[model samples]
Target chain A: MKNYLENINKAFESRARLGIMSVLMVEEKVDFNTLKDTLQLTDGNLASHLRALEEAEYLRVEKQFVGRKPQTTYYASPAGREAFKSHLDALEQLILNNRQKD
Target chain B: MKNYLENINKAFESRARLGIMSVLMVEEKVDFNTLKDTLQLTDGNLASHLRALEEAEYLRVEKQFVGRKPQTTYYASPAGREAFKSHLDALEQLILNNRQKD
Candidate 1:
């Protein structure tokens, strides 16, 4: 069965992943160490999540050398923005639907 | 490692559960049918998620007889409110932290 809710992107169901998407949604792109420090995530955990999003093709990765040091940057792909938008729209709809009860 | 982010409740990470909380957070209380209609959730799916929150003690349920029929209403308990607040704070912090890059 194809559930409409399933399209909301379970990949971002995790707070960490959702946070990463939220960050990328606004910023043009963000680098690794900044994402780590900003999100207060451990190297392993952050990298793991980055890989997950990367594999999902929801994120665009740019590998560059900054002063002879490897620096990786992340961006939300077009599909990623669409998925996140749908996810947020689902949330907003939920909130909107319940407003009469509020 | 006891990461501070772990303190954020994972229970409401799902959109459905978070929607439930967001509804209860504002409404004094909501009944089963209302929640179902508002969330557009199936009976089994809604019941399971409700059970998950109930088990977490984040939700308060009041059962009574309305016209000889059983009626169940849900409320967000104080602890549930606190946990949800912390979760939202974490989200806000993530957005806040990334503003510099945005």
Candidate 2:
């Protein structure tokens, strides 16, 4: 049987943004440097993408002081979580369809 | 509860490519012109993307003659279907997480 692909299509929005979402999806909150290292993204590039997601309200950012330096952490919002789940379901169906074909 | 976001992140791959996958997910088979119109993509642009997808083995193209003209139909291959499904699953989780926040 053929699987539906709407969520798969949505997956094509932006690679960096997607990565950020993935990282944020698992951890309750992640530090900026850790995210950068994990995703191997340059500071500017990561900041730009994070700004976009923040603007879309998919993520929330918190800034604070850690010792003498500044720290920024990110977390996924509830809406973002729901969107991801639905997208996952659609993707799973697509995979199932392909497996059946094989 | 906090939701995961890997699938949501995967949704940012490519808008047009995602759209193509979305349409194919529901339809058993789709024609080139129909896909072009549905996506509102230029002939060359659509053809280029289709070529990439076909190359990736995500889609299959069948060319035939309809009446006196040529017709091309496309379908998602098994691998392509699986990839698309996994991608969708990631995206759905992202959305779900966001929704819960509200």
Q: Where does model 1 exceed 4 Å of error?
A: A1-9, A19-52, A60-78, A81-102, B1-7
Name the lDDT value of residue B25 in candidate 2: 79
Kindly list the per-residue Cα lDDT of model 2 for residues A1-102, writing each as its tens digit: 223544543432565665677677778999999888877789999898888777777788999999999999999899776665565565556445544544
The best candidate by TM-score is 1
Off by over 4 Å in 2: A1-3, A8-13, B1-12, B15-30, B34-45, B54-67, B72-102
lDDT of each: 0.78, 0.71
Cα-based lDDT at residue B101, candidate 2: 47
